[model samples]
Target: MNIFKKNNNLFYLIYFFLYLTLITGFIFDENPAGGGKKDYLLLQVHLIETGFTNGVMHYLFDFFPNGTLQHSPIYYIIIYYLKSIFSPDIIRLIIIHIFLIIPFYFYKSLKLINIGNKYICILIPIIFFISPNFRSVALWSGREILSLLFLIISIFNFIKFQKNKNTKNIYLSFFFLILGSYISPEIGIISIVYFYKLIRLINLRFFFKLFFFNLILSLPFLYYIIFFYSDNEFNNPLLVNLYKNLSSFFSSICIVTIPFIIFKDIKKYFLFILENKKLIIFILFISFFILNSPYNYEFGGGVIYRLLNLYGFEKIIFIFGFLGFLNLIFLIKEKLYYNLFVIIIFILHTSLNLHFFQKYIDLTYLFYFIFLFDSKKINDYFNNSILVKLFLTYNLIYYIANISYRIY
Candidate 1:
């Protein structure tokens, strides 16, 4: 199991080289290569005008087409500061910032968990670089980047809580969770996990304190929506039509990864189950409850706005996806099962990716894989042999193609 016995150094060197290539590609495409040119342009303009003043909130509340509001102004303010220095290339720099944050956050999270091997972090950037769906966000200008940033921050705090159940750390986790919710309401689904952590205290005083803080934090957004949101939900028939099937088969596949992801971890998972059964079951129940809840599926009316509203839970799906893959990898590495069952299920999950989001999903899969792969046993197999070279080449090709697309 000496995964790093041969050429681990070379592997890491090339991995980071590819990561930089993707960063360059994303930075060069600042003019809107895809469908979000206008969004970036508007954000860049707004950043120039507003500085750090929270004017973007007023803008989104007043004129954003969907009447959807963002929760945090911190990222916008940061962008404003960057714009002041970069001037003409502010958009490009901002995107570079987003692209860079993935690796930065990835490194930080792993380091926090004591798994931050240079080689492991290197492999992660390589995997994420190959993910075309990540490129979609890497190229866009919106709150997805902000949501991801805050989500990673929250995860860092969660890991902190995992190690030390300090009240301050727990509150810090919840605070970032709330910030993430404001950044992209879709990511709010992670709040249930946050709530679970809070409720674990089970004391009435702590419960009231958490509840009151959440309420006070939400008040500004609630008031703004009630007083200023002018969009009429009842008037949109097309939205109504979409509401019914919002969580239809496609979303289910995306969120659940079907039978394989579900069974992948079930068959081989021993570490967490053996170590923390109660917490594991709690996660499972909450994950299922959120996915099957009525609000997750399309309702009968105001389909468009409501359809967008349904996205708030996707963050939960993302977290579960990470866990599911990690469980399978751990199972395989531990020799818990020497069968093809895990491979078969993952293939089935891959087969259903007709809409091409699997590549992006692979990012989380790879994240968990490399994080765990850095263990001493797995690192023993890291040979800088031909097989490793070929694997690294495959990842580099993905970066090359994406960079070529941006340049040509």
Candidate 2:
């Protein structure tokens, strides 16, 4: 008895058309477009060819010693078998990474927020495709989407357990949280957020069991890290370049949060800014000190990093001043607490992935938008003049710009 079944058919038809459109694009793409996808493809193909046998994935230690072994063994093993049969196809990657997981995550997140309309739930994924970041990331054939699926599933189950006190959901959450982190530790930092609930639910004995099991699962990876660190960029005395990490983190945060200000009532946005002048100054000062600290990720150069190279720490403070100005909109006007997990996700994501985040911002930014709506508002406003034309118009323009933007 869903009220929006009529609209649901139209969206399904639209999605089917979009699916076909994306398939045509994929068909023409000869050089796999994502960052690190080709590398992962090569690794999987190599693993199978070179005696990656008998459940001993120790080849992870031999082949990807630069901490690439940090990727969960399951993904490579799965891909190895797939490539063995299918000859290293990109379509398999696309079906699992882009078409399957990303859209499902958006749907689940919408449902978690109590968005009930089937049509509205569907809108989240469609709108995601409009984003410039999505086109690039989906094309870039990486394991990030796989990690995102596990991350989202874990979050959902944890929150479900919180509400229902369901042990089954909690166990599933633990499994997924570990699996997701093993794939990409960046998104797995979400485990920290669940600590708030874990503290309330678990006794000391259960904690010991949880710790012991996860430790056993993680032991090989822990050993890999110790051996891997010796020859890596982090082997240098300075683990990360501080000024770079913070500024990059600040820039990425702005990308996800700035749109609310850019698209909304600017007068009120600045009024709140003007009202909170002191807080803004304080934030900039603090951001300045923070930017002086670690550059965490192994950076892949891009337009953002190039421009950042030209600016000084003073310039970074000035820019954060601008983002701080826009943030007034969230702090004063919107119910920012509703997105506490998302806000934390973005913060930790940027913090952890400062080096290579430019190529990967698509992973989490789309979810920020996915969780931005409620079912009622989505239904009411999806066809509104501003949405049907203006917003989508902007997103489509951005999408086109990214076509030639060099994903790989």
Q: Name the best candidate (by TM-score).
A: 2
Residue 230, candidate 1: alpha-carbon lDDT: 32
- lDDT tens digits by residue: candidate 1, 1-408: 343334456656765686676567556663312324555665656544643354665545544424232224445555665666776455655664666666666656766655533355444555455544455556654555666667677777766776777777767766776786665443444555456555765577977887788678867755654565434342334233233222232232233222233332444345556776787667566555432323332332111223345776443443343354344444354533422343332333222211222232333433323332223433332322332344456545654654466568
How many clashing pairs does model 2 include?
Answer: 5
How far in Å is the alpha carbon of 204 misplaced in model 1?
Answer: 3.6
Model 2 CA lDDT for position 7: 60
Residue 114 in model 2: shift from native, Å?
A: 1.1
Residue 394, candidate 2: alpha-carbon lDDT: 57
Report residue 256 deviation for candidate 1 (angstroms).
Answer: 9.9
Tell me each candidate's TM-score.
0.54, 0.74
Q: What are the per-residue Cα lDDT tens digits for candidate 2 across 15-115?
A: 67766655565566522223444554465555556636644445565544544333445566666666656745553554434545656655555455555
Those runs of model 1 whose alpha carbons end farther than 4 Å from true positions after fitting are 1-15, 27-33, 36-61, 65-88, 111-119, 139-141, 233-408
